[model samples]
Target chain A: MADAKVIPFDDDRSRGGGAQRPVRRRPASGGRRKADAAAVRDAALSPLPGPQTGEAGPGPDAGPAAPAEPVRGARSAASGASGDAGGAGDAQQDGAPVTAAGETPVTADGGWDRRIAGGLAFLRRRITGDYEVDEFGYDAELTDHVLMSMLRPMYQKYFRVEVKGIENIPSEGGALVVANHSGTVPLDGLMLQVAVHDNHPADRHLRLLAADLVFMLPVVNELARKAGHTLACAEDAERLLQRGEVVGVMPEGFKGIGKPFSERYKLQRFGRGGFVSTALRAGVPIVPCSIVGAEEIYPMIGNAKTLARLLGFPYFPVTPTFPWLGPLGAVPLPTKWTIQFGEPIPTDGYPPEAAEDPMLMFNLTDQVREQIQHTLYKLLVQRRSVFF
Target chain B: MGKVVLVTGVARQLGGRLVRRIQRDPEVDRVIGVDAEGPGHHLGGAEFVRADIRRPAIARVLAEHAVDTVVHLDVTGTPLGAGGRTAVKETNVIGTMQLLGACQKSPTVKRLVIKSSTSVYGSAPRDPAVFTETTPPKSLPSGGFAKDAVEVEGYVRGFARRRPDVAVCVLRFANILGPCADSPLADFFSLPVMPTVFGYDPRLQFVHEDDVIDVLRIALHEPRRGTLNSGTFNIAGDGVLTLSQCSRRLGRPTLPLLLPAVTWVGSALRTVGFTDFSPEQIRLLTHGRVVSTVQMRETLGFRPKYTTAETFADFARSRGPGLLPPETLAEAVDRVAAALSIGVLDGAPVEDGGPAVTQTTHSSGQPG
Candidate 1:
């Protein structure tokens, strides 16, 4: 195996006010050099946090020896060469082929060693500094490469989602995606995100505005953040739209997700049209997204209200197979899915101040809800069977 | 050549250095340096006035100097030259109160530049994603220098209300990091082994001490008018670095302390000489704090030369290793003996019978 290259990320800036030092290029796969550089570089420029290691412990006389002066000047004086790669996101991106997966620059059209090397390089990039995430903690590289790869099979082969009106979504610019939320487990949202990214020619990522509960959980929160789901608030939506990113919102929130199997396809209140106002303010279009087949995924037959209350969940759903067949009951019914994106409701036509008018907001909200409900009824009539 | 500046706490590194910078500026005629004690470093040709700002006589110094511009750099998070917490509070709060009172009365004092800390925006769980200048902290600082800073800003606001003519520019600086900077945060980062709250990797922000000097100079030389000048602005380098990422980069491994016993970790570290891990800082470590610099760019018209990450990296660049591992030095005698004797052998009662706290001087593993 060849020794990886170590580059000084910011040679001049990390040197403090001192003159630039020589950039070390070790060829013997000095792996620690990268981690050391990464760790040290990051810390060298950081505000040395207080914990004045005064060289004297808590002895009666040691207190004064811990003068604030030595503590301030000591560590910074210790930095030197290690400071250059401090803040680079890819500093420790050495060793594992994980981070370099994005820019491997190697082809597989070769012998076994070449193939292994190419594979290693890709893995290295994937694990290291090769990925880019937005300020909201959404990793574009991961979603495009890893996440979509895993979900694409289900989106196309398993559930067989047939997306319509992909042309209705603008190729570029800030837009709001208001979709119906369903499927007892709410696979619809993830499917919708995949739908936009894979179906669209430009392949733009969707920033989903999720409820606070999603972020409150431990593992779910991290995955959700990396998947680009921010708090479902007007502020977050507006910011996303302002950044020219496509934002998806299911304003129905918990009500839409926890509703009984009977009222499955019914559209819940759009939460006072906050998404509409966000679109209006940003002067962007609102694409009404309708997903059919999700409601049947987990037919909500009953509710464990007491258990949900005790467990702090919005609602504990009891599907026909769930809670009775144990874990196997949890598997989603492979219902054929049809996702139809309707004509974009142009919020740009209204004045920016129109977002402020409650009457207008209510009317616009109703219009969107009516459009989605009407589409749901039409799609239901066109559908053949649940599993077909 | 127009602004006659009066700099408080000239004995400190930032204040002392700023005084020298002000003296070189062709924009000013006279610069008066005020401190309780004389400056440790030479201030070239700047006049020194030995006076305690906590005392009423500071008003006399302000009036006598005919100081048109006042730069308050005396507020500190840690009691460095000052004796204890009581003294730090007096210097920070009482000093700022008296100085503001003096500025209110001083008819010539038109511009007041206050060097504040972002600690005013207390680190709490429910804090906004990014705090603007106006967002109130979810939980106010209950103790430590953060509380003192919050109080100091309040007094400054009161002064601003009384003296509407004075263009007061309050800069809420993030943790100031530089080779020569001594802050509570500096001491924490410089520790041989960092003890982080378990399961938390709070984002940290910082302003280079050099940037701090520059921004103060900007506020002093060119004070913005109306609400822009009077309004408080958050000053920090762009972007942030998380705690674990920082520890990893610094070659310092972290001991994840359970949340409830965080204070105990502070005391344990203190016994081992890593002092100054206050409750407020612990909270900060638990949940990182970040502020927006949009106002600093648009209103204050100062773009930081270093981002938060860059400032930290520079600070890290100048630090000497707390303890060098035996393997790193090739010309050493018996590497095995050096390693076994100091560690991986019989553990002594920790250099001077202090508690055997986690001492990870350079146990960052092969970095691989």
Candidate 2:
């Protein structure tokens, strides 16, 4: 019950505002994976002074009471996975009273002033070209302050994404998160990134592997690169994993996202498991994830094959309201969404040669595929309706 | 017992500077500067020999000097004083061939240093994030300096095989940027209003012109205890900058055009004799190139003083002021910050005040 109060709509933004505060510091504690769930619960319940209490009220209760229950579960599960981040909760608790006691004088005015100063500093830095991008062209500062904030509203209010079993992801180290792709467009990927970021105790970023088409397009190419998405190739994937990043790959590619409305939940055949070999070579774990509710967002009833070929697209989706409604039909429907991260399959136990072994790669790929398919079926069965 | 060095392309700015620096080295007894034309400027104390490397006559000069160390600084991206694309190709490709042939026959030539450009790694959508020395280019250059560099490298490789005894070192330098840089990229950045590809902002890397001379100097000399030896290495500074970032730092406004329009503008500028806006250069501006400098550090045993950003900054200082002054931009930023904070404090949140207060307390007490 105490944990339910922590589900604020803009916690991520609040964290951004307090960029100068010591609250952003990672705790110096040792491994405490067992305390993850408790830490998350305690962090949620920690008291905050002033305006935050007013803002937190409408976030979770925006939907029905039934949906609010799972959101609490989602937060707990997310926190549980990042055991080392137990220190984050304790640190916040220690800082809470200091802010609360000084609520009137220091907290209210100082917070807004600091936020405005930070905004100005950010603008100045961007204009003066004072920023660092990694070799893969990932701009972490821009993604955090600008891009993530832009997407948080949609992830929080529109689909109301609930995450489950987040504890399955390792708090640190390289990980390959394999998820079934859907939603006519790949909005699910963005939502999945948001779910992992907001729920996890450590708030680790997910570096997504995108297709070549993403890089070929004009505006999308620059945005995608800035948002830390690299080409979905073995070299890039291996390079990212070797650097200890959490990489998200959708092996199904266009096939899963462009499937017809008749086969919404039926999992498509994942392409030759290149992701598995990449993980094996890097000696990291692979976490299988299943996303529900993205399929119903657009509800593709038919594929316009002729138009697709003409436009040089994989498929031109003819959704229920699309084409007839023109630009207005582009908006996705409001559907209740749930994303579940399953247990990570460790590939470190295998020999270095295992990456080259076709049999082992194929078997591991099938095992991961089956686990995601099974979870999808279960989540579908538990659902009361498409739109809650 | 002292070394006799032959430095080609002394007529150009960089070559003249390099020849002057090499002449000062105490270990070298003599330095011979060779080119098609005599040096217009000073070359310190180095002997100037007016001879074309593209002809067989270069062999007589190489043998007469008994040049043991040969530094090829002639491979250029654009025509320097008075030459076109064809002239550039002849000097780069044919010149290198004739010089290598002379080196093969002249037994005194034991050390060779060739300056190659990173444009050989043609930019494309499918390229790796960072290119190492061994990474084959994803796409071969269609035409221009890039293709010429690729061919020149190929000939160098063949020459290396023939003379395995020769300590041949090939240095592939990234876009050279510095106070005295006369590179195509430098000229492009110096334009009053730079034209950019509409949707793409490419990540570019640069090495200081001083660093190139330093690396070449090390490569030309014989291997001592802990210095460069014979091998192919990528030379670049420590960091990368986006094309947009470069424009902003230079305080210049960009004219974003569609890809086709950009191509049209490139040729238009070329015809007007503004700069050599070749197709390869356009491809570079579209999908920028970056190379790994690990070998340059560990294997070659050299560390560049200026980073990519610092090199660009040095280059930017030489070019005069832009339309938008730095002080005006700074003042605007400060004013906006103050106004925004004050506005938020006085208004907005209070307008929805009553409803927000009740909603906050209601939600907080509901759990209890």
Candidate 3:
């Protein structure tokens, strides 16, 4: 009964809306599954005693041993089956289930033998009815353990990401995370997801609002859904906010991701500030996020126009290495990435009716865009080099 | 004061049981149970009168009984009770038309409760994340009970317009499942090998039969006097489960079928004699549908006793297990695997579980 909270009208928009995290904390089992899933994924990805036989590659064609997404959401319904979550602390003997080495499961689930065994165990549980996904197809067990681990190597060692002003991220409740988008491919969004999860004070998961194209690709679509990225629509965003999730949005979309290398870091129009009206309607704050060094990851020099149209991509990016170096060129350059979270722009003060005002929306959109641009400039100035 | 009550479809188990339940209440003087064919079960403390609601004779029955309250339960979604497609449509659409015609003329009929289905909210690729009470369905149901429900709700809305004095309550119930309640979803879940679309596992919601009866009783007992009460509501237990989760819990292995091959599977199911396994049902299995019950709780003032998981669990319990024991070697292995999973999962979080991780306790403590 306590958590049956309808969207309260009396949002204390004053910055001192302190420590509202208790009412806003996600249901423990769901949170724990994600935390645990990510934990498992981390263990699996970490280098072990054996050779690196199968690392998940980072290209349009990721290897067969790609970062795992569940057959189900790894979320929503099945993963929320916290009925068995309390038994989480019972064993340390999973690592050598086949060999009976009696070593802990940390090394066990990570090893190649244990990898196949762990995957089988996961599959067996799914078939036998232990794993469940929530409505959104989110299996925290899958996302944290499988999807996140797949993205972690690129996030941690490759990019060598530096995050700043994470405390500016409100600890709880809904806040619209507005960020600049760039690169021939939008790896920035994925890196930001990793950054938020790894850096935020609460280790809160960022539900990125993605475009339809992301959900159109078969494997890519499923992985995006499992990782908590939803369709970039107002209805979806409002639902996430109402449930107290920190929503991430990149307004530039294809325009940001498909820009010429010459125009990189130059802010594009914020799509008429639809994201602002979403925040206004939901009565949440807007946190401006500035991502630096994503521009050089894939420098788009020219567009292979016919090829792009043939393949249904916005543009076929002609980076210096791409189409020349072939498959290997699809791998991103290890640019030094720095993500800064600026102070939040409060939207709760306005009445819900204000979302209807175009002029007001335009101004608020400008306010958010200006804040992000300023931060991007500041961070860019502070950077020593492109690759660090 | 007690009101004279008339209940339709008393031939069905739900209507029959409802009539008996209402008869015990001191708020009624007489109970007129109308059905074309009487159920084999006894209807104590109530009068059973054979009447075809689709025919004009229903108006005579309504006037003769002076029925002050009407509980229309004959809008059957499946052919199991309604016979054929035409017959189900007639009972759902034409029968509702005739019943509404009768109620319109009868000055005594001041309160109306029509049982509707959430199937009216058809499944589609481009639907809203959640359907509130007022959200127009994405794809309207085409030749099934779902379509009939849409038309039935339309007529009820029309009736509300013509006779503002009458209290019209339209309940859009989710797939109803319980031990004794038989419906299409129940039949499908009851199958040994449930066939599902290969790549999709849509979200599912359900309302227990007990909750359905309880809400119906609440509707008849507590009449609303305000503006918001007359509107439609989506009824389902809290939380949701995927198609995979439901089949797994039911202990039925799902045979994944490709998209184009799904209709054949549906026809195969129908040939095997499942009533709700039409093309519309195929769409539901593929996309799945969910409706918000905020109106059900905040405005309608009734909370389901069972959450989604608990409701499905009840159905699974009632259905019992298949060839295996309740606890199998697989389950025993899972318990160990789950324990291993938790330990491995919790290990990484220990390093990441900074001061913020403990903040949940701190915040809960702050309030204290």
Clashes of each: 62, 1, 24
Candidate 3 differs from the real structure by a C-alpha RMSD in angstroms, to one decimal, of: 11.9
Residue-level lDDT of model 1, residues B1-368, one tens digit each, is: 37789999898888989999889888899999999988889987999999999999999998887899999999987665647678988999999999998898889998999988898889754455567888788789999989999999999988988988888889999989999987877888788877777655566788998898888888887654531555789999888766654654554556776766878888776566456888898978766777888899988888999987678778777775434322232213224334433221121111111011111111121111
TM-score (0 to 1) for chain A, all models? 0.70, 0.76, 0.70
Top of the candidates by TM-score = 2
* TM-score of the first chain in candidate 2 relative to the native first chain: 0.76
lDDT of 1 by residue, A286-375 (tens): 999898989898899899999999998988989989989999999888887877788899988887678889999999899989999999
Quick one: ranking by TM-score, best first?
2, 3, 1
Q: What docking grade does candidate 3 earn?
A: incorrect
Instruction: Write candidate 2's Cα lDDT for B1-368 as tens digits.
Output: 88999999998888988988888888898999999988888999889999999999999999998989999989998786777889999999999999999999999999999999899999998887788888888899999999999999999999999999999999999999888788889899988888989878788999998888888888888666776578999999998888877887887778888999999999999998889999999999988888888888888888998999999888888887676544466567777766764432221111111222223422221111
A1-388 per-residue lDDT for model 3 (tens digits): 1111200101110011222212122233334434443443333322221223432122122222123211111211222323222122111111112212223234323433333334444544444545555556666655554566566667655776656666677889998999999987878999998777755647578889888777555446555666777778888888888888899999998899899999978899998789999998889999999999899999999999999999988899999999899999898888878777888989889987999999999999999899899888877776656876
The lDDT-based order of candidates, best leading, equals 2, 3, 1
For model 2, residues A90-138, the per-residue Cα lDDT tens digits are 3333343333233324333543354455445655556666678877777
Sorted by DockQ, highest first, which candidate order results?
2, 3, 1
What are the Cα lDDT values of the candidates?
0.68, 0.76, 0.70
- The TM-scores, one per candidate, come to 0.72, 0.83, 0.76
